[model samples]
Target: MDSIDEVLGELPLPPYVTAEDVGFAVKALAVHAAEQWPDGPRCRNDRAPHPCRLHRWGQRVLDQRGLTDRQVQVLIAEQQAPQR
Candidate 1:
């Protein structure tokens, strides 16, 4: 873990995972997707370590909602698609 991560700590999770929460989670995961860096992979959004706080929170929410890895990928892809 990075020094900043240690200082900032992990983001809190929602008490109840709802459909809206799932949507937000999907968005979070997609927006916070990892980026390659000279040091290593980091968060594209916040530029924190890979699987940043928001990213981990999103994955946790989706896991709580019973979404599999494949399902999560699909959700991310759908979000990435251009709106017609």
Candidate 2:
């Protein structure tokens, strides 16, 4: 973990996961997708380590909501789709 991560700790989960929270989680996962770097993978959005705080938080939220991996993939794909 990076210094900032160590200092700040993980993002907190909501007391209750809701559809709106799922939407935000999907957006976070999509936007924070990994990027290949010379050193290694990093967060595409924040340039932090792969699976940065927000990404991990989003995943946890999805998992808590009982979403399967395939479902998460579909959500991410839909989030990434271009608007008409």
Q: Taking the candidates one at a time, how many backbone clashes does each contain?
A: 0, 0
Best by lDDT: 2
lDDT of 2: 0.94
Task: State in Å the error of residue 7, model 1.
Answer: 2.6
Name the top TM-score candidate.
2
| Regions more than 4 Å wrong, model 1 | none
Can you tell me which runs of candidate 2 are displaced by over 4 Å?
none
Worst 10 residues of 2 by lDDT: 75-84
- Models, CA RMSD each: 1.2, 0.7
Model 2 TM-score, all chains together: 0.96
Q: What tens digits encode model 2's per-residue C-alpha lDDT throughout 6-72? A: 9999999999999999999999999999999998999999999898999999999999999999999
| TM-scores for every candidate against the unseen true structure | 0.90, 0.96
